[model samples]
Target: MAPTNLELVTLGHRIRHERVARGWTLDELGAQVGVAGSQLSLIENGKREPKLSLVQAIAHATGLEVTDLLAAEPPNRRAALEIELERAQASPVFRSLGIPPVKVTKGMPDETIESILGLHRELDRREREAIATPEEARRANTELRLRMRERDNYLPEIEKLAEKQLAAAGHVSGALTHRTVSIMAERLGFELLYVNDLPRSARSVTDLENGRIYLPPASIPGGHGLRSMALQAMAHRLLGHQRPTSYADFLQQRLEINYFAACCLIPETNGVAFLQQAKKDRNLAVEDFRDAFGVTHEAAAMRMTNLMTQHLGIRLHFLRVDGSGAISRVYENDDLPLPMDVTGAVDGQIACRKWSARAAFSEQNRTTEHYQYTDTPAGTFWCATQTGTTADGEFSISVGVPFDDARWFRGRETTKRAVSSCPDEACCRRAPSELTSRWEGKAWPSARVHMQMFTPLPRGNFPGVDDSEVYAFLERHA
Candidate 1:
């Protein structure tokens, strides 16, 4: 592959340094290398990448090896400063500022260059600091989701680990009890403690030094399947995760811990056994799975995705969409045609209002699961969505499969159906032509901006965690 622009610049610095050290002019070096003086000057100025033969010839003429000419660092401090300036100017951050770049010439004072570099450094540092929030988060989340989809969202190692932990706790072939969860924690050398004074920002906290996991009181709201929180805390220790150094690390660690907790809550061997039996009976339903495991509808739905493709040979997708039609969590390897932003991230992107995830929110009988067959451009899919309320407000959790694979699920007979031409704006996003003609210029609706989108992710060792508050709470409890 050809060297990058930066590489060419550094290489040029080295070549120029060698000739100057030998007190030779560009024409003199050109004479020895059998190249035109102007061409050689261009190579020295980082405007040209020399051929390997010419590089070798120049190296031989300069009494140095080709390796010396291709060294990574610029040959002098002046060259280093110049190279840094050139790179910073070429960056998108610098270009976005709309400042014209200064032309670095031989007569430009080093002091002036240093002043300009200092300003660039400050602007560059600010850019790096702000990038770790949403944009980087979206990119990381998008990449991680694609990876999980590629692997059928199954991790055999985590499944085995869960089985081992369960066996050690003497749990076999049933819904994992709270007692079993505490026993598993004991086996891992940790004790579970419930407290009302736990920090609000933290769902659960692990005191690694004291071998204790602190959780909120049992009476807290949305309490069913709360065992997963403690299990997730234990998972960090089991997985040997450290403080995340980047947004990607934060996202990966979160995914792993959640995967571990899901595996523990729904042991692979027994869970798959239950699912296989259901499939044999031709009666697969998310509610049945949730009742059997005593988990929330969301957990049960997500677990089916993990096992269905890997064990039952059925490909599917899962979505957790909010009442406003924004997708909060999603997974699909079956080409369900989810809405996505430029980064391929579905989270925070609005799901088509025609899809079951959004349609379920409007259902009158939300106590029962909502089922529908959506005829999308990709293919028809059968989906089961269960809407629920939490502190964050209403959300619909859905699991879907292709029209052909819908027979394996219980909601196959529902007459409810919708046709979606999304992501075509005309499908749902655009207003009707008659409405537009009547009120296009007259209507001025107030848009509600979601502040969470503009908020920066919490900074410090652990994301969104206040270290001092956690320590104080642990101290008072200790």
Candidate 2:
């Protein structure tokens, strides 16, 4: 095994050849694979060896088996940097980043982790530099923190929006029905090839000559939408030319498509109907809405949020908290002037205390636990328990709405209770055994809090919609 110089040289040549075939430039390849262009060049020329991980990356990127790469026929040796550049070009990272392909030799160091950290830091620094004022910087920091905290839930919406856009552009079809697109592709005699998730770089590519389509894998459990998207790429290949000039353009086109699709699927009037049902039926939970509308819980919540704001004129603040006391996502109607930095823990605390005090006071006063409090910045408020699902698990949503002096309650104290105390601490305040422990002591027990107000609109606002029509729609749909 130690006597094979030819095997090593052959590997380098194979790597270089694959890189060139992929249409990548050496520098671009180097950046993608976390190596200097010069370093990749050296590897390609057989002057230096790349690490095993790099070889694996090259194999994956070039669609070559690892054993085959290590066993290719040796070619005449080139300059070291040239070989390295060639090797780097044939890597998944390079392909994802749109870098040129490069050939790499065995034994190079793995720099991907360092490179990722460096990139993240650079982005953070750039964001900081873009700020014009301390207040702006603080606000950005708070938003960033909130995003990080709510990433699991918030990011899914981003993905959904992206999918919607792709579908709208005819770049994807049958997103609403997963298997429909795939069956169509099979009928067209196209083989489905899956690539890694590329974030903003996620793309679908078609080879004009060979009719090969490459597409990013679905980020969620369902593959139907992704399959449809892949079939669309195949259609593009068959149609020929008119390639998108830039990734941004592609994304924009897709987003527009999705917006139109959403409008079509969930019309403004339909949204109004959902809101009317919520208004009339006190027993209507998030699940009931999902069942009624044939949508996911998040979708239902988002729809309700939008309708309550845009149509019914409701200013609503909504948040989701899991049983573990972690706040998930928050959506507020524009009219509700809540502070942007409100933490999930704080909202959870408000919810738990309110519920606990209500139960306790109900027993003492010999009355129902439901009551209104007027101490907070939001003024007189009605509180209720709503339920929803989270990435981690199920959750109870505690909703609070201000009824009077909304301006005073906008940023002032809401009630006499502290936002962090556990009402049952003596008996039940142990560390949560789940993943929400990090957010446990913050302020709220729930994962999220969304609060908003509902506004009554004129009869003609939703042209064909009246209160009875809205109720009838819900009855049929729900």
lDDT of 1 by residue, 267-332 (tens): 898889999999998889999998887788998999998999999999999999987988989999
Q: Give the per-residue lDDT digits (tens) of candidate 2, residues 1-478.
A: 3524444556666777778878877777777777887887777656677788988877877788888677655433333333334444444444566644332334543354334435545644443333333343234434543443342212334335434444444433212444434444444565556655332323554443444455666644444346445644544433342533323333334433333334323344444566566655434344455455444445455545544444444454555555544445455433222323333223323233333222333333422222334233333443433443448555644334445322222222334332323344432345456735666567655655433223221122221124354344334433
TM-score of 1: 0.73
Evaluated at residue 388, the lDDT of candidate 1 is 94
Q: What lDDT does candidate 2 reach at residue 158?
A: 35
lDDT of all predictions: 0.89, 0.45
- All candidates: TM-score: 0.73, 0.33
Q: How accurate is candidate 1 locally (lDDT)?
A: 0.89
